[model samples]
Target: MMTRSRLMLAATFLLLSAPLAAAQDGEPEVDCENAQVQIEMNICADRDYQAADGELNAAYKAAMAAAREMDEQAGEMGEHYVGAADALKRAQRAWIGYRDGQCELAGFEARGGSMEPMLVSGCLADLTRKRTAELKAVSAISGN
Candidate 1:
C-alpha cells in the first residue's frame, strides 16, 4: 500500500513530466531575415515572393485539412497530430505577413527611382526563399 505522501508526489511528478514531454516534442523555430537590401532588389523580388507565399498558403491549407481528417479518424491520437498541424499553419500565416511587410520596406528606398520595381522584386525573392525554407522545415518536422 502506498502512503498518501507518496501518491501525492507521484501525481506531481506526472503533472510536471507531461508538460516537459510535450515541450520536448514541440515545433522548431522558423528563421527570417532583417537585413537591408537595395531598392532595385525590392522591386524585382516582390512579385515572385508574393507568388511563393500564395503557393505556401495553399499547401498549408491542404495539409491542415488532411490533419483535421486524421484527427477525426484518430479518436484519441488525433489531438497531438492536429495540434502540430495547426501550429505550422499559424506560423505560415505569420510568415506571409512578415514577408509582405519586409518587401514593402525594401521598396521604400526606391520610391522615385526607375529601378524601384526591380529592387522591390529582388527583395521579395530573397525573403520568399527564406520563407520557403522555414515552411519546408516545418513541413518536414510535422511529417506533412
Candidate 2:
C-alpha cells in the first residue's frame, strides 16, 4: 500500500500530465474537396485567420500587463486586490473566446474550400486588430 503523501504526489502528476498526453494526439485535419475553389479560399481565408491569432496574442499580453497594473493600483488604494485580479482574468477569458468565435464566423463563407484556412486566418487578424484597439482604450482609461 502507498503512503498518503505518495498518493497525493501521484494524483498531482497525473493531473499535470493529462493535458500533455491529450495534446500529443493531434487535432483533426481539414478537408478541401473543391480543387477549383482552393486558390481563392486559401488567399481570402488563411490571411485573416493568421492575423486574428497574432492580434489575440498581442492583446492578451497587453491585457495581462494592464491587469497587473490595476492590481498594483488597487493595492496602493487599500482596495481588494483579488477583485481586480479576478476582473482582469475574467476579461481576458472573455476576450479570448470572443476573438476565436469572431474569427471562426468570419471564415464561415469558405469553410469547406481551400480558401477556408485563408479566410479564417484573415478573420482572426482583423478581429485581433479590433480587440487590440479596445484594449488600448481600456489602458487609456486606466492610465496604464
Candidate 3:
C-alpha cells in the first residue's frame, strides 16, 4: 500500500509540472534585452509598452496644462475659449477606448497562443508613441 501511494504521488507531481516544464523549456536563455525565445520576446514587448506609456503620460500632462492655460487666457481676455481643456479631457477618454480596442483586436492574430500578449503590447507601444507626439505638438501649439 505504501509503495502504491508513493507511485501515485509521483505521478500526480509529474502531471502538475508538465505545463510548467513546457513553459520553462521556452525560456530566453539570456537577458530579456537579448531574449532569444517567445516568452522573453513577450516580456521585452511588455517592457517597451510600459516605457511608451510613461512617455505618453508625461506628454498628456503637459498638453492638459497647456489646454488649461489656453482656457484661462481666453476667459481672462473675454474671448470664446472653445473649452479646450474640456475637449482635451473628452478626447483623451475616447482615445483610451480606441487604443484598448485596437490593441485587443491586434492580439487576435495570436489568439490563444503565447504570442498574443506580445502582439497586444507592441500595438499599444506603437499607438502610445504616436499619441505622445500628437500631445507634444498640441502643447507646442498652445505656447505653454
Can you give the TM-score per candidate against the true fold? 0.49, 0.54, 0.77
Per-residue error for 37 in candidate 1, Å, reads 20
Which pairs of residues collide in model 3? none
Better of 2 and 3 by lDDT: 3
Better of 1 and 2 by TM-score: 2
Q: For model 2, give the 10-residue run with minimal summed lDDT.
A: 27-36
How far is 86's C-alpha from truth in model 2 (Å)?
A: 2.7
Alpha-carbon local distance difference test for all models = 0.62, 0.67, 0.89
- The order of the candidates by TM-score, greatest first, is 3, 2, 1
lDDT (10s digit) by residue, model 1, range 4-55: 9999999999986874576479722212243134432343244456676677
- Which segments of candidate 3 are over 4 A away from where they belong? 1-30
Cα lDDT tens digits for candidate 3, 53-87:
99999999999999988888789877675489899
Candidate 2 lDDT over 1-144, as tens digits, reads 999999999999998787567647852223345324554456445544565567667766676677677777778877755365577668778877986787678668977765667766766767667777777766666666
TM-score of 2: 0.54
Candidate 3 to truth, TM: 0.77
